[model samples]
Target: MIRRRTLLGAAALAALATGAFAQDDKTKVGFIYVGPVGDGGWSYEHNQGRLAVEEHFGDKVETVYQESVPEGADAERVMTQMALSGADLIFTTSFGYMDPTMNVAAKFPDVKFEHATGYKTAENVSNYSARFYEGRAVQGLIAGRMTKSNKIGYIASFPIPEVIRGINAAYLAAKKVNPDVEFNVVWAFTWFDPAKEADAAKALIEQGADVVLQHTDSTAPQAAAAEAGNVITFGQASDMGEYAPMPRVSSIIDNWAPYYIDRVQAVMDGTWESKSTWDGIAPGMVEIGEISDAVPADVKAEALALKDAIASGETHPFTGPINKQDGSAWLVEGETADDGTLAGMDFYVEGLSGDIPN
Candidate 1:
């Protein structure tokens, strides 16, 4: 009877040890997206990164995501639930989730948090973003050369620094190539609203804008531009290749998979830390999608040259003799914008009409 009891006790201990080892071997990664995974833009690219994490880690890692999570109270609640469910690391893939991410990080000090396109960080939270402005400079070169009309339009999302930087960089490049070019800006306020994005594109087309650029996360503007017949547009975030060769002459592709894999690896190895990372073309974080044949051969060559210059550090997108919207000198000749100024960019550069909206 004593021998039987000893055998059962040893088996129970082994089972508990195996269970603990299993838990220790696996890491749970979570994601919070501001739009649907099918948006085919920002959220879609982020989701692709999430899938990359799963692919790279396989049985060692599990990923969970909540899509179309609106910023604000809902975001906080969703993040809380993710942390409560044993997520080892969570990525909040939106600028508006900055505050909520901090709040959740404070409550769950053990869980690591990464917020995209945001500056705020805590002991447990890290911020990351791509220098999308580099890609925008290439788009602007294409837009300026391709526009039959001197008028170009921009469909802006929120007035965040990231969006504003894209606008300024594109405008600067366009202005460099076409001195007579003018920008008509329209603020959509929402990041992923298809109807609103389409309406803004239509409005720009009606106003003689032959070239349209958007910071919003939808292909609706491309559709609108396609319907407008003579208009040209560029893809945002992901390549909306369906409209290629015409509406989407070229694109700004956000490549987040490599970075996502690296961060997940760090978490798995217990080496993750709260750090800020802003990568651009040089690191392959921001890719300029193929410029279609619809663009003149010479123009395409020039755009590619500009991309190379930016990547090689031979050119700075925000280099001056640039001015603020009020026509005040912002960067003197031979001067370049610092990371501090660019990260908190709130004003439009000179030649871009209207206010940035509060």
Candidate 2:
């Protein structure tokens, strides 16, 4: 464990970035990104956010990144290394890094730790996540309107709360669009395995799926959609337009730069505090990429309108009559998912077939 004050003073990242940070030397931020910058999806977008930290604050902030670090043991190792390298604030960018982030946080009580998509909290560790599920709901509506097979294929990574929430949101929105729609989920169980993700996409296609969605962190699934012909796809983390351009109907984008910059700036200004954050469209955490022209004009108009309403705090996707997979009521009619249910969403909906083995 390394001291946050020690790291900030010892590291020269901020001093070099701009004179804004050189005035006080208060924050040294380090990020543990879960994927390669070239992966063109989840991890890539996050790294871009890290870059934004340097761009905006200049020398007022310091940012160091460890790319392609897997979420388990590798995550712990990276956190330790970053701590040793003198980091004041550390951001662990994946759900699997929860325990590791906590373990390291315990050793370095002075350093601030922020874990994404993880639900643990500590005196020094706070959790944060983007409402990607909300954006997925929009994608689902489009998928329902576009799909001809009535079968939407989903490429799932792990059955964590984050993944489950997205699946349910997508399903709920699709049901609203077309009640006959059914989602066939193929669990790849790996967050960013390109080959396995591609295989899952192909499997769903072979099983008569016409529209493909993914919770995995690769472009391979979208590529498979293109190869299968006439299948529709959506971007997961970043704009995956390079893959099956025409088939990729739209995307659930991650624009995390603004939040990252704000957090870093706060730390530099000595106003940083530990608090959980679950920012959604209201705060611009959830974003949409360019919709392909292949989609009909009417569908595009509807999607944009829905997106605007959600951003303006006029709508919510989790309003219920919502029930668990067992059909046990979770939320009453008009009741929405507070942060608790969404954070602890560990099961699939009734129509979803796979078991969420705890």
Best by TM-score: 1
Candidate 1: tens digits of C-alpha lDDT, residues 2-63 = 56444543443343343333345479888989999999899999999999889988988988
RMSD of each: 9.8, 5.6
lDDT of 2 by residue, 1-358 (tens): 2354344433433332443333345467888777778888988988889888888878767777766666666567668767766678888898989999999999998788889888899988888899998898889889988989899998888879898899999998888888899999877878888888888899999999999999888899888888889999999988888863567878988888998887777666767787898988778888888888888999888878878877876778777877788888888888878888788988776666667655
Model 1 weakest lDDT span, ten residues long: 13-22
Q: What is the lDDT for 318 in model 1? A: 93
TM-score of 2: 0.90
User: How far off is model 1, as Cα RMSD?
Assistant: 9.8
Candidates in order have lDDT scores of 0.90, 0.82
Which pairs of residues collide in model 2? Answer: 17-58, 17-59, 18-58, 18-59, 21-60
Clashing pairs for predicted structure model 1, backbone only: none
